[model samples]
Target: MAEFLANYLPAWLAYMVAGAIHVGLIINLVAVGALVFIWLERKISGRIQDRLGPTRVGGKFGWLQTLADGLKLLTKEDLVPGGADKMLFRIAPYVSFCASIAAFLAIPFAGGDYPFIVQHVNTGVFFVLAVLGLEVFGVILAGYASASKWSLFGAMREAAQVVSYEVPLGLCAVVPVMLAGSLDLVVIGDVQQGWFTNWLIFHDPATFLIFWVYFTCATASVNRAPFDLAEAESELVAGFHTEYSGLRWSFFFMAEYGSMFSVSLLASILFLGGWNGPLPITEWLGLTAANGDIAWYIGQVLGVINVIGKAVAGVCVMMWIRWTLPRLRIDQVMATCLKYCTPLAAAFFLGAVAWQWSLPGRTFFGLLESPAELQSVSEGWSDATAAATDEDEPEASEDQTVSSEPSRKVAAAKLTGAAALQIASTNLQGGK
Candidate 1:
């Protein structure tokens, strides 16, 4: 669409328009997703506690309860403490919300010849983790600027908890990158395209252990229960955002839900098969990139749905954990990360490396072979090797040559393009 617009409009204008559209879509996703999750949390928590939740707001299920709450918040007063640093306090929510939204730029919703990503960064995993870590800064700023002891304490706890958890989180995420041999998330997800056994979580015994570690750290990283010490309402009276109200408080909630969905989607790409389903239904039905453009588009749409479904399922599990388990103390949270998650992630990382080295091309308990397609696509060396093989092959009959030429040319073009991309990515990384 942007390309089409470039024909009629200036290139810069077309790009700006496309970028704005993408931004709007992502913003709506975060806003609407927060609304939905808020309703779900209330309903789910109510059921867990054997009570009805929000029956009066929007009919039987109270579907419009979030909208009602939003209206109420909008009408509430926006107050700044008399002693507060007004500028910092005012800007903090936007900082948090913007940081959460920025992480989605590198996140791909679907994969194909053209993936559904905003920016498509090469080091997507690292970029996301780094951006997510910055969210705590907003909390710290908000707490310190508010001039409240409880808020200051909450901010300090959040800073400590998030910083500590990132260690294990990075370690756990690296296991998949090691197995895939690429830092590009699209390539990582593409490598897992097949049955459920192809998912990184099931690739080996070590990865299975690492997946759990990754989830634990992910939960803590996002400040969810039972690791939500930053917002221990019973103890700290609303924690870091205690003084925040109205739309500003809503921004914090939006940021939280956005981070939740972001981490869940990251998990899907890292440990699950990503946009690919457990079965090869799309492949069987001929709805693949190899088909036609329309077929490819349809396949991509389904891929989006598949990826979103998996992400939503992950969020639901987090909600279940929140309602079912008691919130851990700040001490317990730190101990869980440093003593348990970190060491376990480190051991699992080593085990995964050894397993990959020893087994080579094995997956799923050695019952299936690991796909070499992603490696072949991302490595410039493979293109050189393929060219050499083609040159060394015996001459074929005219009829045979004619029939195979198109496919060979297409393959060569794709390999050359991928190799070029790989080189550019390497240069960019080195420059950084």
Candidate 2:
């Protein structure tokens, strides 16, 4: 879009205009997502507890309940404790809001030639996770700036909680990246194309286990209920935002909901088949470039719908879990991360590594052989190395590459670990 506009406008202005459009779209997504999720939460909670959640505001379902609530908040007085630091208190909510929404920049809703993403980051998974983590900073600032002991206490818990869970969260995230052999989420999604069984969650027992752990850590990381120690209203009196009110207070909730959706979307892309549906309906419908651009565009639209549906379902599960479970004490929360999630993540990671090493060709999904293109870790790195190189001369001629292939494969196999070492020693003795 910027390139097209550059023909008629200043280059900088064109880029700025394009950026503004993306920002506006993201802002709307955050706003609208918050509205829908809040309403969903009420209805879900109502259903779980056997009650009508919101039946009056927008007709039968009361869809306008959240919108009305937003208006009420807007009319309420914006409050800051007299003791609070003025500047930090004012900016903290926006900080959280910005960080949460920034994660969406790299989250692709659809892929192929025209992916629906504001930024196609190479290390997209890492980038999204890292940016999402930054939301804690905003909470910390709000807590400290408020000059309330309860707020500070809440902030401390959040800091400890988020930092601890990030370990397991990262580990769980890596399992899919490892399986897919790329940090680029589009590539990761592409690798899972074909059948429902091809999804990373079904790749192996290890991956299957880690997906749950990932979901748990994601829940805790976002400060959702059952692990919402940072916002234990019953104990800490509204926690980090104790002194905040009105629309500024609403920003915190907006950030929280937006973060929830972001993590859910990340989970969808990482473990589910992403834009690919269980049945390859698009492919089955002949929605491919072979037909025409219109056909291909329709396929992408289907993909977008597939991914969004998965993400929304993930959000609903979160809402269900939130209302179903009791909030854990801070100690229990920390133990869940350190004593359980982290070790399981580590074990599964090792299992996935061993499984990939020993049975690279096997899959539980089809009980069938993997495709020929499934590369070993060392081969992946070799490809990466070749791509990264910009030497005066080409690194390897075609003949040299062909001749070295078997030896390279052998060497790569030996790079696995202790078993590989023992095998190499046995091979050396046999050769001698």
Candidate 3:
């Protein structure tokens, strides 16, 4: 018992502790970032309207306004409508929140040899995109459960808006995945090393334009104003969430802001250089250690700063747009997404493809190297050397080199990884 406990307990306990830490950190990020963004939004919106937003709550910036709001929501009575579907109504906000939180699972907060991701999935791009779509289900259920005509209308509108906009958003997102040549976000980030011009947004003219389309679609998808006809105050009152109050209502807002940040973070990864900045400060400063001990820590710190900086910038831009732009009508919103954004994004994708084909072995702006060619050259050289070294030794006969089940499984995993890498390479070629 003592031997077993000594052998297994430490590692098991460490894993449990690490898991707890990661969950706590992620929860804090979502909760705290939401509070900060809300405060910033109020302050920015106030300035735009030439009025004071929050003054006394948390001193100079009213930073504690969200905290106060949270307390108010918590203290308020949780009410249910007489005709509402009780179970669904009660469960709706949590559903939305869960979906929003789940997408963060595969998101790399810091990218490096060992990324600061909760789960490093091979199909991370598809997984995040798929789960993000689930957020609409909660809204739909909320609208239906509210037992109000206005709420139902708002929910249906929101559902339709998200469904329609998602098409273009996916397309726009694919443009970056195509450029990066990998669904593994860490690999994508790694490929964009060096300068900002190497970022997918600047990969080509089409991608550059597609980035805007992605941003617009992402904003609309998250039900931000201008595209927020679902919650049009004059038209639908409080929209799908009309029946919600107190903590329940607050949860919906939290989910919204959380998703807004998630999409922005996604945008930062897909278009920007993710955790990598234009300057390779970590590399230039030699923050990495020879044994990859100290360097990894410094790299993670820098990466976190880089990704957060980009995400905050994205949020600020969204707030600015919200304050500056007038709301688009539902019809106009549909037209902008389908008729304008989709077609434009598609055309840019093709243009980028043509540009890449026209200019092989060349950088986008003559400042950075083509990541594809660089990888290919490096891998080819390494493989050649390995093959040459192997040739000097006697080769094992086919009969002598038998593969076991575990070995076969290992081989299969390698093959799958290779296939994914191959597909990524092909997609990058096409994207160019």
Model 2 lDDT at residue 96: 95
Q: What local lDDT score does residue 278 receive in model 3, on the 0 to 100 scale?
A: 88
Model 1, 90-199: lDDT tens digits are 99999999999998989999876589998889778888988998899889999899999889878877877787778778878787776665667887788888778888
**TM-score of each candidate?**
0.86, 0.86, 0.83
The lDDT, on a scale of 0 to 1, for candidate 1 is 0.81
Give the residue spans of candidate 2 off by over 4 A.
4-10, 371-432
How much does each candidate deviate from the true structure in C-alpha RMSD? 10.9, 10.7, 10.1
The candidate 2 region of ten consecutive residues with least summed lDDT is 395-404
Cα-based lDDT at residue 112, candidate 2: 78
Q: How much lDDT does each candidate structure score?
A: 0.81, 0.81, 0.76
Weakest 10 consecutive residues of candidate 3 by summed lDDT = 396-405
So what's the TM-score on candidate 1? 0.86
lDDT of 3 at 31: 83
